[model samples]
Target chain A: MSNATNLDGAITLITGAGRGIGFGIAEVLSERGSVIAISDLDADAAGTASDAINSTGGQAAAFQGDTTSQDSMDALAAAVLQEFGHIDILVCNAGVIGAPGYQDRTEHTEADWDATFGVNVKGLVHTTNSVTPHMCERNTGRVVNIASQAGRKPRGARIALGSVQSPYTVSKAAVIQWTHLLAVELAPHNITVNAVCPGVLWTPMWETIAENQKANNPELSELTSREIFDLSINERMPMGREQTPRDIGKAVAFLASDDASEITGQALNVNGGAVMN
Target chain B: MPESSLGQLAGKVALVTGGARGIGLGIATVLVERGATVALCDLAQTACDKAVSDLGAAGHSVLGTVADVTSRDSMESAVANVNTTLGGIDILVANAGVWASEGYENRPEYNDADWDITHSVNVRGVVNATEAVIPYMKEHKRGKIVNIASHGGRKPRGTATGRTLGMPYSVSKAGVIQWTHLLAVELAPFNINVNAVCPGELWTSMIEGIFTNRQNLVGGGSGGSVRNEYDEFMQTTVPLGRGQTPRDIGKAVAFLASDDAAEITGQALNVNGGARMN
Candidate 1:
């Protein structure tokens, strides 16, 4: 609403906030003046993160909640309301890769699909649904869903051989479409819903992918993390370097802020220059 | 594409459809000013010749050709002559388009011929031109294609009849929207970048004609006047409280067609005055 960058007094919630992309988002959101509530399945890790935020003079609390459970989702919302009064931004960043080697079509199982979707797709919905009513009443809110470039551009050496087929891709694609639908539905209420499609960053997901590739082919030596990320935009990723989680965090913060009020139903790519659209 | 022109487009050649006027002419004018051998193509030979001669007289290497965008043979010949005369094609601006039924007076019984012509010139013509030059681009391993769409393709035009004269125009523009993505994906392998620009209302001759024709066909209705209707739409709908200019659209097209947009393929960018952020 204002040109100022101060996000002071904003109430923000991030799912799967223990580490990796979720933690990256939390750190940036807190730095920009938001009082954050970090939700994670691992209560201990979340506590440590909350403590870190507190030590840095940012208001934050940890909620040990399983995203797959409706009871946990409602409880997280209740706790946040009791602590912060209202929620202004919802970051649907929780996700899981399931077990290793699950991407191999021949080795995949229904359990892998259900597990990935339960935490990635259903989890996002549960968290977002928790914040909608409060945001609707306020007539001001921002919802940022973190998707992957893989969801839009299905390209990988293993994908060609049906080796990388997995529920992760399906779940992420669902997230992107879900963002699009919510954007229109919430337009009348002055709420903006957007998704960010980030390519391979130096995150835990990249490590998982690299390890999976090595496990699938013992003869194939693991490439450097930079090498893996460099391949995101056919190595022409315009930012001219591998992506750091900070790049994704900066974009998430920008979208969640008032500066992006006019932007909605759009999927902004923060993949260094990969996936420009 | 050719040794990175160092921003010349200098040694390269370019062509823009609908180049006789409006946004197309704006882009053609910029390209020529930048030192690229440019060509102007339009449905009317007289108009095309006039534009070419005018630009040529100003010390620019420019050509004018009468061609139907929807015609494959015409596009092939136009592209061939540019190649023969300038040696190669570097940039292609597919900016020609027509938008009738602006005020939705002919909602139910709108001219079928008008719809057919819009689709032919706006959508199919783009495909024909792109497909024609893609082969040579693949061989050369680089190219840039800019397709002009509209913000109307994304939002609905609300009117009392609820017709809004949008179905045909929006449908055709939507096709261009999807075509940008399809072409981007297909040409990325060949080092070619394909992008689309969705312009908001602009002060162009074509827009003036639409307003004048709307007033001639239908009275101001409940509104005060045609000018009043235009003012209300611009001030109320757009956040910036203003409209775009041909030069504004030109700057956006130039960005997408340049190396700055090298990694920006499959993108449908809005050059609206903050009307539609996506």
Candidate 2:
């Protein structure tokens, strides 16, 4: 078996565990034997993830909490603590890409920025802040934040050319910086904080963006929309290709595990060579 | 293009340097399954022949060649052979590399010969292979280069010996990053993508080399081989509590080589299992 396999019996909590990268992480972690706590904005979505895990004979529980709300974060953390006793791992994976057409700093409204920051940045902060105290008490813990490559390099074309926009990019950048900051602070507590920056992945979010572009940009056909989405990264890395949610999940699992103890305060790139750090 | 979308890389040609074993071999295995004709080149002729034959037995359009990535002439010949046989070169995985450093206290003094050899294979080797194939890509106006680096290159020297004890390996890897960046910008006009894949520690010949080096340095004692301590050290540090496998890196390399990553350019993808966030 691979060293990364068989993650059984570890108690782990994941924010935004309902779907996408967060859900993917939950799935892999469970497969590797981590007892999971799935937290999401939608209770039903979180239940679905927990149910999927249960169906596979894995131990999991679902918690519904508004990612942008402190009360929600606290309640979820409390529930996990009550049921699981202690959380060995925390994944602040909840995030948003913001509303479409919210391009350029000038066009971006304060409300839009606030909403994006609330979900992407503040949501992460709330989740981490809630779990870290317990973790610090234990003197051993792992926090994996889901960031975006947009945080590192501001490739305007990545947003302007496709579905993502300023709020998502800005919020992700904040998450990355915050990760570094937290890493430094938490390292002394023996708690490692790191972010997983993903490149483009074919997900429901991507489909929604593609559909919106097709419907909104009436001048372009559906086929053109697909091509436009395909042309995003400029394909600079000749050997391999784009980031996948599972790819990010695997990296997160690795980080959350004991194998990465010496690795503190580092931003790991899981973008399939799309963004090299 | 996620979740092993069937035939994503159908009808493509790929060349993986140092593809005889380890992460490179894993990448070649995946690409072949995805319907790409794979060409694996290694400095060791016996290893290359064995890999090619074994992969060929698996019903893949796979070929093996003996070539040193450190030498431009060797790389050129290998690329030329692949081009003639495979019809054209579309994907280049500059994955051939050697780890010469074990850290400071492990070796005490830096070995210049080890450092030079490491750079030749890791840095100059990647440059040589990419440079030799770029003209073909320029002719076709499209290509991809994935340079394999390490997560060790990303962090500071943790232990005295810096894990493997050689400064050149880390320095060369740093060079790999810049080289990837430079190539990415220059090849943009040619529609060629150049990126680096910084893999975390995996169980490969490279790691084995580190183990052997550590064992020799420490000699026979109650501690036994240095690999054990190194493995324990990795276990404690990696968030995931595990080391990466070759296939883990292979799947990532496969994604970067596929059309799904068309928009990605001049970037480094860390497959280190949360060891590095950026």
Candidate 3:
């Protein structure tokens, strides 16, 4: 598809950009002429991703930052601002789906809840707090949060991944609500905040989920992990297809561009007919 | 406005149905503010002209035309006129809708007239507007359509304290949402994005009328005003602790109409202050 966003000369910061949806967003933004700053917990993976982009004639820099830590995000922000001179967009893509034990609320641990919220909710706050000041100083910026369709509706037994009672689902719900709250608060700075809700992406997160489901459910012992994943996607997704990281990247890139200036405080669902609302 | 600061709808032509007042006028105002030439279509020529004059007084490029949304011929004629005068209809805000006053008490025998009026204006009206504009949009291979729906459509039918949006209105709005989804898929190949905006508890004239009717129905000897009832409902229901304004709805519509929402389709965006998350 032709790129409609004019992100040329823009500086973008993406958390968890080492792989999955974050890396996809970084690659798309780089192709659109953005100087990408890849911040991930894995320093080596972040560096490799940044090098790959730079080798493709794109401007990119890698920085290691733990999204769950405010101080780490602050340092990452300073490094990115110093290198790029100004930050134009911030994509909050770092998130965590708690362990298999966290799927059932009755059996879930407090630690599981904390881990999920720390990365999904608090991490969002840290990154937004760190970079929004610079955006407010310049009176312009874009914040695209990668939320999940699970936030919109509870996933019952229809999906084999995250349960409706899981902390991951609760955390994503918080992310969507936070998108609304922050959009209202930051609209005056001309900084648009929006969330992209992706449906059933076959990422490393899904691989772990499939493994856990197969291990726990005895009826699914005959099925391979890939087959189990495909079965879930086919049953749950109305479009009968799984979403790609690039699909999410395209949605984020559009929201980050100047074309979406009037769009703030909205959650755009990139799910393939999974959750209409 | 500076060239850079101009809205994304600059140089675009838009047609908003039922634009004489309420949410329709709000959508039209925002479109005009964003530099689009807007045509306000309503059933009454006098009201349409007054709305146009009101917007024109603010130095906006606006026009008023008479077209009954329930009548396909009227809508086609109105759209044809807008295409002739405004160059072409690049954006369509199908805001023409009507609310039935019948409550759940009359659910069994809800007058045929009441139900027909609600569906005719809300459901068929949206279809008429979309059908009228689709040809122009398909020929151009570019368009944006925003349908004004309500939170009542998303929620189940039940009257709790302050929640009394009539069952017919709720059903009609639900149809609007479903229609928006189906049309979005069909129109995507044409590059036209179709979406619905569901507003919650806005203090519009229509809603004020509903509150007054409710007060008359249940007020009895109580000395409470309808405004007080509305305030009470907002406090108990809305998480944001307040109701949304027409401007909030307008801004959301403007965003969906803009190129910023180019990839967004088959979606119903709720701008109801977190009252309905889904």
Instruction: Give the clashing residue pairs of candidate 3, or none.
Output: none
iRMSD values, candidates in order: 10.6, 8.2, 7.6
User: Per-residue lDDT for B104-139 in model 3, tens only?
Assistant: 332333466667888999999999999999998999
For each of the candidates, give the backbone clash count.
0, 70, 0
Q: Which DockQ-derived CAPRI band holds candidate 3?
A: incorrect
Model 3 Cα lDDT, one tens digit per residue, A1-277: 1124558899999999999989988987887788999999999999999999999888999999999899999999999989989999999999887744542333446777888899999999999989999999998889999998888875445454334237777899899999988977776677778899988788888776776777667777688878988988767654456778877887787678754554567787876555677
DockQ of each: 0.07, 0.13, 0.13
lDDT of 2 by residue, A245-275 (tens): 7667777776776545545566665554555
Off by over 4 Å in 3: A1-14, A17-39, A42-63, A68-91, A96-144, A150-194, A199-267, A271-275, B1-6, B101-111, B157-159, B162-165, B220-225, B228-232
Error of 1 at A74 (Å): 0.5
For model 1, the DockQ equals: 0.07
After superposition, candidate 1 runs with Cα above 4 Å error? A1-6, A99-107, A153-164, A222-240, B1-149, B152-266, B269-278
lDDT at residue B26 of model 2 (Cα atoms): 87
**Candidate 2: which stretches are off by over 4 Å?**
A1-65, A70-117, A125-150, A153-171, A177-276, B1-5, B57-61, B101-107, B157-159, B162-164, B218-222
Candidate 3: residue A18 lDDT (0-100): 93
> lDDT per model, in order?
0.73, 0.75, 0.80
